[model samples]
Target: MNSDTPQLKSFRSFEARQDGDRQTSRSESYLRTGRESSVISATIQADSTGRDMSIDLDVSADATHLKRFVVSVDFGTTFSSISFLILPRNTPPDSLDPHILYHHIQTIDHFPEEPCLGLAESRKEVPTEIWYPKEEYLEDSIMGDGTGSDDSPEGDMPFHLQNEDEENTYWGYEVYSCQRIDTDPNQNRRMGGFKLLFDESELTAQIRLDLEPTLDMMKKKKIIKDREDVISHYLKHLFSHAKEELSEKHEYTNDCPLGFVLCVPPIWTPKACRIMQTNMVRAIQESGYGSFGNCIDNLFIVSEPEAAAAYVIESTTTVLPKEAFMLLDAGGGTVDAITYTVNQTCPLRLEAEGVEAGGALCGSSYLNKAFQEHLSARLKDEDYLERNGISIRSIVDTEVVKFENNIKRKIDIIRPTSVFEFVEIQDLRADPRKNFGRNRLRLTHNDLRGIFLPVLEKVSGLMERQLELAKMRRINVTKVILIGGFANSPSLRSFLKRKLASIKSYQDEDIPLWARRRFLVPSSEPSTRETGRDASAVQVMDFDVMNRSILMTSLLTGESFPIASLWMAGST
Candidate 1:
């Protein structure tokens, strides 16, 4: 909120002024602040000579807007999107040309309704959530675990628990969720807590850049803090950053007419929906976007699957004639299936089903369990477990970290170095004396593969069950769409493909090419060949399915019955 932010202050134009007015003119402060002011009002432009030209100014002023304005923001758990609305340049509101406005409005080039899916990957949106515990509660939580904390900076966030070993500490989000790190140490190093912030001053610039999406500070507790409050705080920061970016890019003074569409998984319960909505609205307000009494209008909420569906439909040239097809959405969070009957006489009719299992929690949890079981089965007591500080448990923990951080990279490394086997371990206090044993452990790459494979199989089974239910209802299961963050994994896609192959009558070649490519098949993919499989295993992957469904829903959800007015073929 103040110009003292590092990024803002870094600019020569942001220097502090003697007769300072922070609110009235930021440009003055910028010129007088942190850095040397000699370069103030210098505009860098290119000339035909390919040399840079600079223009100096003695005074700076606020920008003015001449037309209607608006902005739309899509805040997701892992990522977010923003768009703008520009009113006609010269026409008055009453004389506005609808067609002209439509023409000027930009439609996303690919998958207009949904964010782009990276090549051969699925899942849209980014996460912007953070987690932290109340200071009052931290002591009790840490004490209940074991060992007392030392005042050393290294152990600043250390945990002391009653039952747990002193050395068995964890940190970061995993610390809270997995009960590993010392509570104090974990809280201190947590990325999303105090450390997550840039100087409120630096935020304006940081937000302008695209930050990688991750739950860096997330804790696994059921209720670490009010989710809404945290989400609102984060959003406020993001919006402020976005505004600064816009200001730097264009000149505008009046409030913009913004529209936003947020996508949620079909399985979001009423409680979750309410929480998300309230948090988002509050976040928008806290971010200063709604401060001037203007807010985003035409806000829309579409299901994850439905958004993907919209992306699919928008990309195609073919139109449906009121027939029902099932949409199976497999993403990071959960698997959802829906039936939509596309008709000419009326809007589409929709019915849906979803389950708790999603790729993020379920698939990842399964992988963890498998790794743990593999370590337990292979190592026994007194088998070099105590000497040299090497043990099966430590290896398991290290492997889990590798699994979470760079499992794919490890897989690539292991594939070339060892006999196709998996390896896993978690030894934070690893001993240098056990170098030889560590080399031997590296040879067990098959162990890692074994752990991940079973979990992939479970995901396949879930899809199969969903397909079966759709078949029972006699609904035409069209494309089985795979989406969400988890859909990006080659392992998951390969396993799902195998499942489809196993279902009766499914030919390997008959599987949709888009499915084989593991990409969200554009709606444009030809639907020429119909699989004769058990009707349950055929799934499609696409980005637009979810949004398209929402668009249709928005259009038709509350409309009055279409009246069949009296008509005669030769009435004219």
Candidate 2:
């Protein structure tokens, strides 16, 4: 264990927000046996409403006392990330300046079994998918019937065959790597999206419809006993790896005070949060973290929007007071559109507006679904299929790498001539009329747009509604901050910009209010005013920013699993 660990190479000064109406609550039992107890002295300030929204938590401590470590997890629907911070113990209950904290904070850039797939670029996130091997994942099961089978007969799928030598449960990239080649859904248990099932009452009819088949399959295969079981196992994977990463980095023994800041979806009820905590505590205990006394006592649960807020504060250099922005978290499974009004600039305080959080099942998964639907229609000839020996889904699953690079991220309305070519099959004869030629499924701009527009339409509607509500409330929304894996799509941003352009003038145009109009005109050509500020409203986060994520939440299996991008933020 080196005396030093990864230093935050980026950022300077730090700021954090504690907004409430004059509330001073102490953290639970910070005492450790044979160690100095933490005593956090906080300076509280009040706003005009007599609500105490000002609190400074960054109080430097002496180097000798003890070391306090903070870990935040984004357990999401499609992908997830982990970050940690280590501070001196002398400050006790004082707050850790997020900028200074983030400077030292490091995200999990490596994972247990990261495969060598043909991805466009490496991201800090790992796939939220997991698998408990039935016949055990062998080296050679890559080609199969796309239904996620281990290429085994019904008789061989019993749980009894799971541990011939060993049946290791794998997560993240390992799941994708193994599931692509070999995985028997009938025998080996594969689970994801359970994070979304924490509260049955919060499940929309559409979510229920999407989740039912998987849940029924899990039941049929006895993959899960209940919601707790699913979360417990998955979290065990996450925590165990987190501990390992920290250990190798700083010789992170379980001696210091370890606290977790978990991010959850806003739509989750208190009961849902409780359910996730119960399972998470169990995972912590089972993982090496509970080796010491009371490691789970200081678990801090924050909403996804709040965590996203934390990320924003860490990134932006200037924030206008009274500035309002709509943060659209679009990921694999779900999209949540929430408008926040900034109360201050430095120690940023956010207040949710009256429009209410607009959440829906339209996410990147829908695009995948639409793509799969297109394949189902095109790839139907039995003989063609027999020659190919691969299902439509198998191609989609395997070519996910390509889809992400081409169709998912780059599909746009502007490129009518652009074409996206999926995996090639030399045996199947090419049919240009059906958009299949040159041995590949070549999707033109229109084809790709058809795949992206429906989902983007839902996303656009979600944003427009909030903008409308904000208009009604006379709250001007300045920037639209786009985050999440789904937000990684360029087409979505373009689509949203076009939607904003199409919006009719809020009031009858008395010479078209150029500078005063609340919403942005996406395109320069259509705006009745100067084109200089056109497309000024939309803000798409870069990949690095998305990778260096903050305000992250996790959930279990989801419409696709994101809330980080807390994806079903599974373990939020």
Candidate 3:
């Protein structure tokens, strides 16, 4: 003990309890006026989440010394997002609130190679992907579309994935743009959807089945030792980038205690959380974030959907007093549906929540998969029609990407298109008799409907299930706020509206989803600043327990399930 401080006595009594989804604590210290003796009794009531999180503390006036420098991560299938906030370290807890915390949250939008891609503004998240390069492609690794393998005149390759660089492991934006020459590791190796594998153990075997050839090549070519090697290595890179961004902005060298908020997928099991936590800790330790224990206090875990819901409800003007809203987190590879009813307005307390899930992996990526399959099957016989199969393959690749970026999101409710012509492939080949092509490309609206139906069916089912749960709980879904990357698709939005129109509880409202302001123009701010229903931490520390900091990480991720520009009264 410091000489000026009073010596503490033994423990008197400690009490803990739960109240819905809120955590509150108060402590009273009894100190004798004589020599030095003190007794502290604390009653901490935290949200009784069945997980290992069980602490809420009261920081004394003297303990509020250092500023809370916060950094958060969302490791997703399609993209990974990071954001940070630096509150005045010396201030006490009473001075800080949710509103003050909202403005300071800044997303790490300026990635290494993002500027040159010609984006009008900064991107909220980097693609969650990794690639290992072959020694043979020294001529260059072109990023954007080129005429052919030998015909690259001008291109914008990712800055982090240069052929001249010594590093072979490329990650994030590095892998986002780079092309995979062949399946063989002798040519190159690329991997995504690794985050999904964290949910299941045998996912390793399943992934091996899909990437058996490429993975086997990576093993033989000595790029990666095994499957875990790829995961751990990829995670290390992600942590390193986050460390760099945090360090540069705040001059934070891990000198002070770091509060980390790791968001868990909604459908993740307890076993899966443990596995992901271990890998995250290891990745942080290896990324030079100091010794993991020294920097990180507790791995604040949160459900992605809930965290996102909290962020939207708090930051925006959209308020639902004693009303339920369906929070649909439609990401790249997964869609999670949950309903939360606001019980109070002052502090925004949610009473009843219904979490009904869709398929394990159901999201917009299925549509991409469907479109790719359509192209492959439709173009396979073209090898006999013309010797330009290689060119045709290149065109299909470009067209598929174009569809994912543009066409997929354009399927709206108000205006609908009948035929979509190929921008690249203008050929006289098969499917001219039907409306599958115009320049040999007349893909009718029905053709697209056939491709979009499967994914739409699954997503619609998720919404319906959530609605049913809400009805069962007697909570009418007054509004539906859709987040996540996939929400940008108007087709999915339109389909869900039609599917749920007949539901009695919903009453066939306009039900506008929060899916605007991403591509055409971004939000006035950067990220969404999501709220955490599962674990919304405040990062209040006592600096006791031998300098252990108590971290409350409300790692609200607005970008991961991006919500900006609210709509009400079922307005579009």
Ranking of predictions according to TM-score: 2, 3, 1
lDDT of each: 0.34, 0.50, 0.50
lDDT for 510 (candidate 1): 25
Tens digits of per-residue lDDT, candidate 2, 32-98, equal: 1111111111111101112221232233332212445566667776666665655543332222233
Tens digits of per-residue lDDT for model 1 on 86-137?
A: 3322222222211112212211111112222334322222233333342322
TM-score of 1: 0.48
Collision count for each candidate, in order: 86, 46, 17
Q: Cα RMSDs of all predictions?
A: 18.7, 14.7, 15.9
> Considering every candidate listed, which one attains the maximal TM-score?
2
Candidate 1 regions exceeding 4 Å error are 1-184, 187-227, 237-254, 269-272, 290-298, 317-325, 344-405, 408-445, 504-572
**In candidate 1, how many clashes are counted?**
86
TM-score of 2: 0.69
TM-scores of the models, in the given order? 0.48, 0.69, 0.65
